[model samples]
Target chain A: DAGITQSPRHKVTETGTPVTLRCHQTENHRYMYWYRQDPGHGLRLIHYSYGVKDTDKGEVSDGYSVSRSKTEDFLLTLESATSSQTSVYFCAIRGDSFQETQYFGPGTRLLVL
Target chain B: AQTVTQSQPEMSVQEAETVTLSCTYDTSENNYYLFWYKQPPSRQMILVIRQEAYKQQNATENRFSVNFQKAAKSFSLKISDSQLGDTAMYFCAFGQVAGGGAQKLVFGQGTRLTINP
Candidate 1:
């Protein structure tokens, strides 16, 4: 509903392989975030960008990297996939307003063998 | 660090009944915000309700409302006239009021709700 889309809705790959997940937003919000959801752990932020080329690490930023070259595109990359990295990834965007509600994407389910 | 805790992992409510989901958070900041998000079997996350810490009155949206106790540091969601479609996983989140007016949310593990026919 927020015009947010996450590409590669489902991905299965082997360990040590490289993988990338993309999140595209048509709203052109000022903030974008990447999160991983796992059973019992809920959703944890991995990386976030406030503007193009302005990014920051989150609570669980290890082994993952992100890039936001433009306002509409945010990408998450796994340099070398690991089994522990398997989870459902979600992308969210929020306006520049204070505590504005965030809009989420459908999510991408990734599995590492 | 701020933390949100959802005590109930699984809960069930009969159709047309009312149910309350409990959420407690730990934060030292006086100015902040709380939110409730719902994720159904479709796995699409949806916002249910929100409450500002500075507000004394709770927030309500249709059949959904929040009992925000700032002193108690608790924010709970109550759903009235629950329906089968209400079944989903609910998450409670906290966000600090940033100086620049940008809010970044910290979320809880979540509670799975099942509405029985």
Candidate 2:
């Protein structure tokens, strides 16, 4: 285990509301990623952070944002929640180079009504 | 853009039997990595096996192994002596290293594997 945890394991929010999910890791990994899992789409990357204050957009970055102010914490925010954003969000950390395994935390299940 | 495809949406195998899951990926980059991740009912993604494109020999982990056919763009996972614990949603992923050592993964839709005991 890489000591990873995602807060608010399950959440329910109404449409147009603001919601933020948090991912905390104790491994001090330099790379952290956020992905959303849907029935037919599998897991699509939402956003990722390489280091403190450095982040980049992923394949499905629309309607989502991410910030990493510290090495241990990475946050994903949905500025205005929508029904399409309802899915399981997973957070993963890569401590080393490309060959290393990316450790994933228990996913956060979010439902937008 | 890189794409990973898993044609089989569901598969079943008897306990102690061997089963293989298929995965194919399309990528122009020569240097990359392929992986198989298992997501059990707990919803935690566990790495089953990984293969580096540069390696000619297949990679194996315990009862799990991968058949990497680079020319055919196919990566398949073989599980020997399957157990009930192996029942889970298996996902195939492709990772490409970008600038600054940031590697991003593209995953397949997943295959639901059931091990009947």
Candidate 3:
């Protein structure tokens, strides 16, 4: 447990509406990541940040955007929510360079109507 | 490009039994990492074990150990003394440095394991 938390453990939104998920970490880690877990596909990275204001796209970054204004918070935004985008999103942090072990948050389950 | 495959979609075993989950990957990179993650009903992703491609010896943690065959491109997790607490969805992933130096991962489909009483 690296003191990571995700906001709105559960959320329901209508298609075409905007949605944003927040990932907060008290670990003060240099690296932060956002991933979406879908049945049969396991988990896929949506986006990641190496530092404040430094973000990069992931394998599945088409419909998602991320912003890191400070070291403590990273936000993932879906400009327009879609039913296909419904999935459980997880936040993670990497503490050191020696170990590749990334600690994860509880996860946020989003449902689109 | 890299891909990880977990052939077993589900498995069940009696408590205190031993269980092995299969995982295979395709990669051309010389340096990379393999990992097993457990997701319980609570939906928390927990790292069970990790294996470095360059390491010759398999990695283990307590009751969990990995059979890492680099030449075969296989990494399997064997859980000894399985308990009800081990019931969860297990996922295997392949990782390497991406274009931006951030670790990128490709995960397997996942295996649902159940520990029976």
Candidate 4:
């Protein structure tokens, strides 16, 4: 809840549809991350950005893509939503210091049928 | 890749008592950070405590404290004077702090804790 907000907190979509989740931060932190939370998997990183226009893939980034055109906004996109992609997504941001703790947003619950 | 493990899937504690949650991690990096996060029923991820690998002193935040043993690769969270509101899912996470301080966290499966009054 650290001045971060995720759009479409709840969404129900159909398979094969495109879905995008937006994370906006007022903290102006240097790091932003996208993660998915499932029953067995507590949280898995999907994508992350270190700076504006700089992005990288994470352990579970295969089916996801991300973009950060600006420092305050990081976007995660599912090109073709699948049932497996249904889960609660979380966005987190960290300050520009090594000792800074990461803060999370509320979360977005995506359901695909 | 660094991996965090929270062995306890669930735990229970009575009000005003104490409970300890165990977490172990694997990391070859010498400089890193370990964190304990609490997720309430509302599903908000809140930071309970944090310890730096280089810091020999254990980290404490009010009733929450951590015992960090770098040699044992262990980091455990101890909650003193437990309250009903402490009932929640707790997750252990690890991250590497780069030169720019950019961080990416790797989390554990989480331990669900129930505090009964």
DockQ of every candidate structure = 0.60, 0.79, 0.68, 0.70
Under CAPRI classification, how is model 3 graded?
medium
- Tens-digit lDDT string for candidate 1 (B86-115): 999999999775423446678999999999
Interface RMSD of each: 2.1, 1.0, 1.6, 1.9
Using TM-score, give the best candidate's number: 2
Q: Which digits, one per residue and each the tens of the lDDT, describe model 2 over residues B40-89?
A: 99999999999999999999999999999999999999999999999999
Error of 2 at B64 (Å): 0.4
Consecutive 10-residue window with the lowest summed lDDT within model 4 chain A: A50-59
The most accurate candidate by lDDT is 2
Q: How displaced is residue A80 in candidate 2, in Å?
A: 0.5
DockQ computed for model 3 against the true two-chain complex using alpha carbons: 0.68
Off by over 4 Å in 1: B97-102
Alpha-carbon shift of residue B16 in model 2 (angstroms): 0.6
* Chain A vs. native, model 1, TM-score: 0.98
Clashing pairs in 3: none
Answer with 2 or 3, whichever has the higher DockQ.
Answer: 2
| lDDT tens digits, residue span A8-105, model 4 | 89999999999999999999898999999999779998888889888888889988999999999999999999999999999999988878899999
Best by DockQ: 2
Candidate 1 is scored at a TM of: 0.97
Candidate 3 lDDT score at position B85: 99
